[model samples]
Target chain A: MERMDLEALNNELLDAVLEKGSLSFVVNRLHQALNKGVLICDCLGRILIGSNSEIEYDIDAYIAKAIDHSEAYYYDQEICQLFFPIGWGKLIAIIIVREVKEEEIENILPVLETANLSLCFYFSKYNAIREVENKYKDLFIQDLLFNNILENEEILAKSKLWGWDFKKEYFVAVIEPDNFINIKTFAEELEYITKKLAKENDIEIITSVRSGTFIVISREKNNQKERVKEMIVEKISRANKYFSEKYDTTFSIGVGHTYLAYKEIYKSYQEAKTALAIARLIGETKFVKYFGTLGIFKLLYKQEAYLLKEYYYETLHKLIEFDKNNNGELLPTLDALISNNMDIKLTAEALFIHVNTLRYRIRKIEEILRIDLSKLENVVNLFVALKIKALLKLHYSDID
Target chain B: MGYGFLFNIDACIGCQACAAACAKKNDFFLGFRRVQKYELKYRGKNVVFYYSNSCNHCENPECLRRCPERLYFKRRDGIVIHKMGECRACLTCLKACPYQAPKFNHQIGKVSKCNLCVDETGDPLQPKCVKACPTFALQLVHEDYYQPMAQYYHLPIDTIGKSHITQPSIKIIIPPELQKNGEN
Candidate 1:
């Protein structure tokens, strides 16, 4: 908007290659130049970069108006915030300035324009780097997951070229987004933020996107098993929370067992995918599940879902039918019994019934299924069948 | 209903061997599976991609709705079975499919599409085209309604056809080298 401001922005452009690589630094420089808080929000109004005070602002409602170039300011008594959209065509990533006066707009517009130019430059640079990085990383991940590398030595050599250490014990984590929301955009942001946070935490990580799920391979620095699990859970859950809050979407994380050999990373990746599938099947969206802890589910998930459903019906249909016919609570009683390890007292207490009543229900279940609950094999069968019933019921919409 | 095909765009060579395999296995005059090619401009560079498509076996099938006789139906595993004997050759399916999946056979005076090799392996379901791909470019992917957007890995529907209308159950992986993250 001014000749002098244009010269100043041009001067900064030449020195940009010397500054630390980040968009926030540019936004911070703009904040210092203007003496007002500034932020760059994506189309969804999620603050991608903020400088000075990281204040939470409920600006989502005005995003459409800001993008449409309708009203540049959301006014209270006067202009409290100014919006300058930064993109092409329907392009609307807003630059919102806090507490900027309308009188100062004549002078501020030029500086804002310079900020917009700097943002574009940074974005273009990021795209250039990401394009080349993603190209090779995708190929490397494909080789790791699908193509057999022939020998551990081969992967060790390849890892060295990628600036990753295959010698470190690595655990593969697969995160699947639970809903639709500008996914490619989210994936880019996720890659940037995850890497940044990992670096800050001093955790070594290599990330790649394949088939829409984010595949993250991070080194296990801790020797204690519990500490490693805790650290990973903490790191991933924190990242998940940030994305869920920012993007209005949830992600399911599945972690596989740690592997010592470079070649075995593929196995861990497969196991993580399996774990993610089971987490989806059982509706365990709240936790980061490990494949080793899945127990019987690990085996059951490998089977065809329809076959599992069929087995569920064959094993428990009689009890279900009886319950429907008589309005009995036998099914719940059996579940409680199996869950309690056939402890008559605990089952009775859980069901809020007498011990005699629990015994009566157990006998009825055994007779109906034609198996003795005292036998471990029969109990195992009932347990597996009940688990299958739970799994299928949660996901019955797929079949119907 | 969640069963679908995942096509790897980068891996495909556009050989049309999948089309031939579909025709041979099903004994039909027209192959149910066909591969479509797209040449697109990404970041000011031309990139050509091949998409091997078949009956998407959508959750809400157009043939099942448009056919006055309701000859087309989806099974539990999401395969759209065109009951060969029941079709009166109304040709509604041929007109309804967005992907042009169904073919009208003048010789048989009926319509047919992919059975997904369901009759081959009944429980798990299989596709002859997937098995025929030498590059392993195609595989079956399953999903639950509650799960995340697993199919978003596919090429955007606008890049190929109006896929959102039928909500086709196919995931076509975008070639990895293009780097489409920027708005350019």
Candidate 2:
């Protein structure tokens, strides 16, 4: 070969090394060194990549069939190679034991090393670029999303992001695992399931961000929030059952309602997460949806009198005393009052208690307190009072 | 009882600074570790995180029980240390560690575990992992006090107790919410 021709070939090889820098590049470089007849086999004598089309071997098979000695081995009118790769184990990449001289194998090893080194350089350069880009992106997002940190009132006031379209709804769901140690495969599985569900629904899920929580932004009308919530509850239930059966541990899900602005998004996320905690406290299995159903707690928190007055605590205390006095009827009445928002029929159906019994309990409480519980506004007040009472006890108990 | 390290999983950003520091601190040959970060998934989100792993210096060290040469020894402070010179390269101790604490050194032809940097001159009584953890994910706590410290915050009391292997005195103080959410 002419000197110019060899130089041109070198340049081409160098270009290949720089551009397609990976295992394939090493294979190509080795092929060039071996006059394109080299076969790369794993330790198991299975041909990894090769020029020989007829050779058949798996990783384990390659280990079994490859010649033990360094010398070339020919069997059944075919040539093969075998050698172990460094920094790995017995069942790793294949070695080619072919009709090659000692000088040829030694010469090709350097070329293969050079190709691998060149590839490593390329990867490092790519990784450096990636690292800078990721750092900038993370910084940008953190500044954009959380610039309004606590006590940064002036910064928060100046931060003018557009209001989210209230027409579109969002939900925050946190996936927490008990032992989040060395479980990357499980995360991939979850992402797969979420993507699949979103695709099947034909809904363009906005804000499908993954942080501590997998916050999915879905479009929901005010009327459709219930339906969407139910769907999520069902999905989580199914997933938990499947996971539990497979892993023998219950997986908890904390789901928050969608908000209009990014600011409210964090609150919703926290609320959903807190709801998950409450669910666990109650020993509810599988999943917990926040803000959608808090039973009596929802109404209790919703009422103004409960927020402003301390009457609820007193009312609950009295009811507890009555219950201890062998009166189990008042507790159900209190639950009914809150569940139905002081409505008799709804409360009766919700508790599965008799409406007459509910009426009698309310009348008895009215007589005890010297207040007319029959009045609509008074009934509402009493319901709120009971919730405040229960909440205080729970909060104090938790503190202790 | 020996005090061990704690990993705050929430604070661990998975930078691998601790792992690199561990490798450098121990002068670890290929694949050996005094400490390293671990990760897991929660719900469906990629909660990218890490934790420091090391010898728990168990109440009952599996490595000690399984050591053929009986080279593994427990100190008064709950550290499980070994003399590399005495090891016969028999890998039974590696198999016995539930946490996989001990690593084989092919170059030295002996087994190695985190020495708590005791051999190093003028060193504080701390492992390379705790000293190097940028996010304070790893900390060498006094064994007796760490349990009550965790229990004070309503966290689980029996982390190492449930393992039933060598009762390594080390424990992790993760976000209380994390265990409630999804921690196995």
How close is every model to the real structure, measured as TM-score?
Answer: 0.58, 0.34
lDDT of each residue in B1-184, candidate 2, tens digit only: 4467666767777776766777886664533343334333434444444445666666545566456565666654556678788788889888767666788887888888877777777745766667777778677777453342223222222232123223357665566444533443
Q: Model 1, range A1-400, lDDT digits (tens) per residue?
A: 4688677765684357236556667777777788888888766666778642455455665566566545543433244677787655555467887787777876787787666666666666766897998888877765665323546788889889988888877888887788875657767766766777676666667888765777888776743333354475566667766677667787878887787646566657766776777766665665678878898985674354567778988888899999989999998898888889889999899999999988888889989989987888988898898887755553343321
Instruction: Please give the distance, in angstroms, between residue A2's alpha carbon in candidate 2 and its true position after superposition.
Output: 46
Q: How many angstroms is the interface RMSD of candidate 2?
A: 21.1
Task: For model 2 chain A, give the 10-residue run with minimal summed lDDT.
Answer: A142-151
Residue range A297-340, candidate 2, lDDT tens digits: 53343233323235654555566667769846776676667676
Instruction: Name the candidate that leads on lDDT.
Output: 1
Residue A298 CA displacement from its true place in model 2, Å: 9.6
Q: Which stretches of candidate 1 lie over 4 Å from their true place?
A: A1-33, A37-53, A56-69, A73-81, A90-93, A148-154, A222-230, A238-248, A282-287, A301-315, A327-380, A390-400, B1-184
**For candidate 1, what is the DockQ-based docking class?**
incorrect
